[model samples]
Target: MNTPEPAYTPINCDYYDRLEAWATMRTVCLLKFYDEEGKEHEVSAVIKDLYVLNKAEYLLADNGLVIRLDRLIAVNNIPVPQSC
Candidate 1:
């Protein structure tokens, strides 16, 4: 027996998306915040040196400190950010 997951967990969603050329340079990411309820969240971490391809799944790692993007759901290309 084990505890069930909450209805909603707060995890910051940050990832790159669909791009023909920059596909190999993009990555999916997630971050947990202190304000989050239950003090826990689910999110994928940065991939290793190897470029993360499509259809990768994420697994919890580093004592839950980090989440790895082993599988990807979807990719969307957004404009890169620029400094002021």
Candidate 2:
């Protein structure tokens, strides 16, 4: 007899939508995410673009950082510094 594997659900779109909104509006946000080894990390940057390919998603930041959407834990609004 063969055994069946468990069903897996994909991550929700709320996180992606919120992030996209922030990116489109050029809003700065502090992001929290867990690394592959379950280590938590945080960073502050302005969202520059959102990308979706197949079932994968990513966020591009102005600082040339690429972040996976599924790894995101939380997003906090931040104020952007003004130029003199």
Candidate 3:
């Protein structure tokens, strides 16, 4: 049986803006986030795009990783706030 995806929590507006900026500038960043199994992972990649899918927001990395906005832990050492 397939497990349902966790409910999407909206991230901070400022962080969202930063992600957009990074995507626009093609700035490589260290992205820290949790996976479906709640395992933490990190990657250094440029943000390629930000888009919405099925009422959830996501960021695409140049390395071909797509991370849900709410799963992000940090971007370049700046922590993602728990509250939006």
lDDT of 2 at 50: 84
lDDT of 1 at 4: 50
User: Residue by residue across 1-84, what tens digits does model 2's lDDT show?
Assistant: 645422222346655566778888898889776655569888899999987765566778899977666666777933222111
Q: Which ten residues in a row have the lowest lDDT in candidate 1?
A: 75-84
Clashing residue pairs in candidate 1 (N, C-alpha, C atoms within 3 angstroms): 17-76, 18-75, 18-76, 45-67, 55-72, 56-70, 56-71, 56-72, 57-70, 57-71
Most accurate candidate by lDDT:
3
Clashing residue pairs for model 2 = none
RMSD of 3: 0.9
| Model 3 alpha-carbon miss at residue 27, Å | 0.4
Worst 10 residues of 2 by lDDT: 75-84
Q: What does candidate 1's lDDT look like per residue over 1-84, in tens digits?
A: 656532332112333222222324434543332221234344444433323223332333323442333222222323222211
Location of the lowest summed lDDT over 10 successive residues in candidate 3: 75-84
Overlapping backbone residue pairs in candidate 2 total: 0
Tens-place lDDT per residue, model 3, 25-74, is: 99999999999899999999999999999999999999899999999999
TM agreement with the true structure for every prediction: 0.21, 0.68, 0.95
Better of 2 and 3 by TM-score: 3
Model 1 scores a C-alpha lDDT of 0.32
**lDDT of candidate model 2 versus the reference:** 0.68
Query: lDDT of model 2 at residue 49?
Result: 90
